[model samples]
Target chain A: MAQEERRILVAVDEGEESLHALSWCLENLVLQNSKDTLILLYVKPPRVVYSTFDGTGYLFSSDITAAMERYGQEVADVVLEKAKKLCNNIEKVINMVENGDPRDVICEMVQKLGADVLVMGSHGYGLIKRAFLGSVSNHCAQNAKCPVLIVKKPKPANGNQ
Target chain B: MAQEERRILVAVDEGEESLHALSWCLENLVLQNSKDTLILLYVKPPRVVYSTFDGTGYLFSSDITAAMERYGQEVADVVLEKAKKLCNNIEKVINMVENGDPRDVICEMVQKLGADVLVMGSHGYGLIKRAFLGSVSNHCAQNAKCPVLIVKKPKPANGNQ
Candidate 1:
């Protein structure tokens, strides 16, 4: 059988760490060949809980929800655009946007797409804070169907945080 | 200036998850080229509280501690040997054994060695359990100077754990 193209799914957000991951993937994982496809995924948490009553105490939930959805889509487009610009071979690029919890959406998409690997960026939360706030990348690492790369931005050499 | 070889550090243990990570690295990350070097690291937690009372009610802490140290070294050797055998190019492999908390040791070594990437295997702990047990891979992902890849073993097809 002829070899299939490698599918690399990268989870990107507005964070600098996510951008670093995309850059690292381009420099290290993405080969200069036609047999690789890089999928840029942006997961927006569903805005169903944002519904609230307006000034008159009447429900304006639908209008607010629609606006939130549009905002989410805009964020996805901007992040994907920046990721595409960083790629040396934009021909292999594909974009995906989904509305759900990122921890769940990422793992689900990896299996649904049959991706060879899933890449993400660490939010750089310390142990105590991560323990309390919960880390999406850490959750995905444990639950994802394929291999996960959680890229961390390099620390400055001066030993400053 | 010519590009320096990329240093890839992989954390291994007796668990199948880690060995799965090593296999995935060889298949996906390591290319048939001379510009990449793989470092296999096994961190043993320091045996500080091995206090023991021997026969005749005498303390045999020193002897027991020595024995434990030896056992730790033996385990390291076995794991490294198995990892080396998995690689097609053993010439580019290096083994490092350190004694400290795995989370602290892994992150420290990544910066000290100037590794381009650090790879590890997820233990598949869920959020509640991981929150208490404290996952090393998750901690390293947050703190490491370089990119971190936490490889998860593929789940069974039947959707059973």
Candidate 2:
């Protein structure tokens, strides 16, 4: 029987770990002459909600918020551009940008896009930091409907554990 | 450049979830005419240490311990047999049985065997049970040297969350 085409969704970010994961997926998962759809998803953080008064009791201006949103878009564009270069040989590649908490957005997109597999990068955070700031890969692995592959960037041989 | 062959390690057990994961890997990850190696690993729980005196002060015999050990081995054989049947089309396949805490044994074997990717099933335990019992897949994903793929069995259409 002929194999069905798969939709592989890869979560990309500004971090080197994410880019490394993208390269690994391209090398290992994407097969030659296969009609697989590679979806590159970059999620921007949700817009910061600011009250009229700042924490220091100073009035918050709309211009600062607009600038921040613009910066977020620019960062997304840069990351997507870098990711696109790595997929030049792929026949079908899609780039997407969404705004929300990455942990939630990634799982939602995987279902929304009917992804066959979800590839992500592990931040390799220590216990303390992971407890304080939750790990996105961990959350998605537990929540995503499809198979989730968490790619860890190998540590330096000379580095400490 | 020619793509390098990869060693893919899969963890299996008596659970239906694991068998489903094996089928998923065979369908999605394993390629035809590729020289990839598929390692099927089944981890038997460590032997239960029995004291001379039982909980009710009854004398415990060596025969009981021996029977338990035999049962563990039999279960491993059964699971490996079932998993092997799914990989009949694959060119290279290896079956392994180890006795220890699965979370530790799996991570150690992934490094020891030089596996490129580790595939396992997600039990999908609830927050309360997962917190108390700990998740082997979660631990391996966090600690393993190579990438970890946690394949979640899709719930029934009418199943509760």
Candidate 3:
């Protein structure tokens, strides 16, 4: 039987929760008997804000920013490594690391790349410090043009998936 | 049996969806084996943009705003009528409509009042909309002192209890 082809985009901060979110997405697709292309997108916001001192415009350098971008890429690598187990023909996986605010970038990239849905981890480092839903996921849910699947942080790992 | 009481604060707006949201919240509590007190909160933003020539502090006179305050009470009546069926040992229901930024007022009220959780339906209209969970629920989920339970707009009602 032919299954529905679903394109799933996940914002990977490359943490345990993100991996769990990816794991959940794959399970959901399996449950739906759907085939999906999974894009693991990561974003790096600049370390410093830039401003124009004169008409020359904002003085911003990409050298350190590029290194930070690579830092995010490295983190994406961590996510990709874990994703390898589920990277089968049923699920085509890709990685992306862009520089910008995570929230805006997720919605923009999903639209630009034509992803059908965004799957995100609800609680993250953002919540640990701030005590709320992760801002990146929250923003995507509010603004994404596509349906968003927010996976709650899994309860204390019970040695089970 | 003396059951633990459930307190829910519903953000009240004169919107089609807000009324539906209240209905869902009450139905949700009816399923659980406990009583609840429903609090209707309305937040009014500054009516006029202040000017230096306006010659007034940021906070204005409540007396001067009495008419607007009365409108707040009117919204309370709407909530009471809606809650009429859902009240059992539901205790007393009350309304509070204050003027300020919708987000700030919602959060401050949650902080000031002891509420177990907040429930909102996913859609808004008028100057303040529940659209995208409205700015209030969005901000409160991030900044409020309590847990928030949001009923997604267009959720599959599929005979869900």
The candidate that wins on DockQ is 2
**Candidate 2 deviation (Cα RMSD):** 4.6
CA RMSD for every model?
Answer: 5.5, 4.6, 10.5
Model 1 clash pairs are: none
Tens digits of per-residue lDDT for model 3, A1-161: 11356567877665566666666556433223335567877665434421211236555576855765566567557756666655554446787877766777888998899876677666532333213223676677677765555555534554534
Error of 2 at A137 (Å): 0.7
For candidate 2, report its TM-score: 0.86
Please give the lDDT score at residue B18 for candidate 2.
82
Predicted structure 3, TM vs. truth? 0.46
Number of backbone clashes in candidate 2: 0
Estimate, for each residue in A90-144, the C-alpha lDDT of model 1 and write its tens digit.
4688888887767788889998998888888886223322333368887887788
Top-TM-score structure, candidate number: 2
Q: Give, for candidate 1 chain A, the lowest lDDT window spanning 10 residues.
A: A124-133
Candidate 2 at residue A7, lDDT? Answer: 93
DockQ of each: 0.41, 0.48, 0.04
Q: List the residue pairs that clash in candidate 3.
A: B123-B130, B124-B129, B124-B130, B124-B131
Q: lDDT tens string, model 1, B109-135?
A: 998998988888886222232333478
- Give Cα-based local distance difference scores for all models: 0.74, 0.80, 0.57
